[model samples]
Target: MKTILITGASSGLGKAIGEYLFHKGYNVFGTSRHPEKVLNSPFPLLALDLNQPETIGRCVGKVIEIAGRIDVLVNNAGVGIMGPLEEIPGDEIRKHFETNLFGPVEVMKAVIPHMRRQGAGHIVNITSIAGYTGLPFRAAYSASKGALELLSEAIRMEVRPFGIKVCNLAPGEFATDIASRRYYTELSPASAYAEVYGRTLELINQQVSGGDDPVMVAYEIEKIINTPDPKIHYKVGPFLSKFSIVLKRILPDKTYEKMLMKHYRL
Candidate 1:
């Protein structure tokens, strides 16, 4: 059986992926900052906090000790932040990147060496469709996921000769508890962005709540793992959400920007 490790498996998309793969009979180990708190998990949860670098190595080590060799590493743990770029605190931005970007990078570092020794492995980084464009209120999220996409491209090539594969799975909005965890800058009446930003925020939350089921993502991940030669990027979501990436590519720069502005009624 192929051993798989997924970060941030406590809830949301990560939990869904872990559950799907576990039932599919893969030897899956998931990471949560507090494993004991995640009760009734089908597979065991390892303690790993993305914000704590020390926990990363230990978590990977525990997986290796238990499973002997990890066939796949899924970097699915991340956080969300939203607000007018100017108003979002610098510290919060840094903290966001720490979880969404640097955390995954470090996890990759921890797992790669063992995969190299085994002479085979795959790493799937869960990115976002928002990464493809600069969304008005999700500037930091866009940058972080975009950076991970590019980083995956670079690492995929670097690890190819070692028999390890790297790819990005960018999902659009899904019905998850992400909105509850997202950090939102205060919407004060005196603030210039209060009216439009508040409206956009509500729309964003609604979109997430009404979005496609995350099981689709779990199925997609399973497909990627089973394919002999997986592509560098895989996008899963609603038709319009997936098509938005294409629209950005073909449409004029300002035209796309205008469309987005109109979508948010900004």
Candidate 2:
């Protein structure tokens, strides 16, 4: 069976993908910051925390030890922050980058040499539609995803020659616990940007309730895994993504800003 390693497999979208793909006959190796939360998974588990390079390296090393070859690497582990840009603390911003952007980079870098030796592999990053278009009060979150998207683009081209393909799956809001744990909340009482922060949280609070099932995003991951040539960017879920991409393309800056303000209910 083809083996796949998925990060963020403890819950939500990553969990769904891991379960679905494992049942579909892939030897799924999964990672969880809290492995006990996913004790029920049929596939083997690894303890992975994006904050620690050692944890990432160890997990990848273990996957290789067991799976022998990693046909797929799903960089799905991520956290969310919901608050105004100015209100969020520097450490919090650093945390956002640590998980969403740098974690994937570190993990992918660790796995690439092994993939190069194997002569074939797929690296799929679970980004967000926010990567393409900015959302209200999610400045750092959006910036992190934007960086992932561009990296996926450049890296995919570079890896193709070695029988490797890198893909970015930009999910439009899916039902995931990431929305519940707004990482951008204040550190203490005397924090800055409270009003804007509240607005950002409110915007995210509203977005999560109106999304498609996490399974849909999982299925998209499955499709890409089976695809002979997946695009550098694959966006799934919501009519809103289409509208957002179009507006971003055709609308003037001020007009697009007006549309986003109204659409996001900000």
Candidate 3:
């Protein structure tokens, strides 16, 4: 059985993926900031905080100790922050990167050595559809995930010679608790962005509530793992969401920008 380690598996897409893989016969271990607090998980949970590199290393070590080898490492743990970049606190922006980008990099650093020794492994980074474009009120998330997307492309080439495969699976909005967990910058009634930002926030929430089942992502991950050679990038979501990438590629820059503005009614 291939041993899989998934981060942020306490709930949402992470939990769904972990449970799916566990029942499919893979030896799966998951990570959370507080594993002891997570009750009745199908797969065992380890303690890990993306903000802390120490926890990342320790969690990876414990997974190796238990599973002997991690055939797949899924960097799925991340936090969301929504606000006008101008008003978002600098500290919050730094904290966001710590979880979304740097922390995942640390996890990858911990696992790559062992995978190198074993001569085979897969690393899947879960990014967001918002990463593909500059979404209104999601500047931080867009920048971070976009960086990860590029980082995946770069590392995929670097790691190929080591028999390590790296790919990014960018998911569009999905039915998850991410909305509740996201950090929302204070919306001041008199602030310049209050009117548009508040409206966009509601729209974002509605999109998440109306999103596709996250199990679709799990099945897509399974397909990627089974493929002898996987692509550097894969996107899963509503047709329009995935097509937005193509639209951006083919449409004039301003045209696309206008479309987004119109969609969000900015």
The candidate that achieves the highest lDDT relative to the unseen native structure:
1
lDDT (CA) per prediction: 0.95, 0.85, 0.94
Candidate 2 regions exceeding 4 Å error are 187-200
Q: Write the per-residue lDDT of candidate 1 for residues 1-266, one digit (tens) a residue.
A: 78999999989999999999999999999999999887889999999999999999999999988889999999999999999999999999999999999999999999999999999999999999999999999999999999999999999999999999999999998999999988888867999999999899989999999999999999999999988899999999999999999999999999999999999999
- lDDT by residue (tens digit), candidate 2, 99-167: 999999999998888899999999999888888877777788889999999988899888889999899
- Candidates in order, TM-scores: namely 0.99, 0.93, 0.99
Candidate 1: lDDT of 157? 97
Better of 1 and 2 by lDDT: 1
All candidates in order of lDDT, best leading: 1, 3, 2
217-261, model 3: which lDDT tens digit per residue?
999999998877899999999999999999999999999999999
Residue pairs clashing in model 1 are none
The runs of at least 3 residues in candidate 1 whose Cα sits more than 4 Å from the true structure, single-residue gaps closed, are none
Candidate 3: segments with Cα more than 4 A from true spot: none
- Whole-model lDDT, candidate 1? 0.95
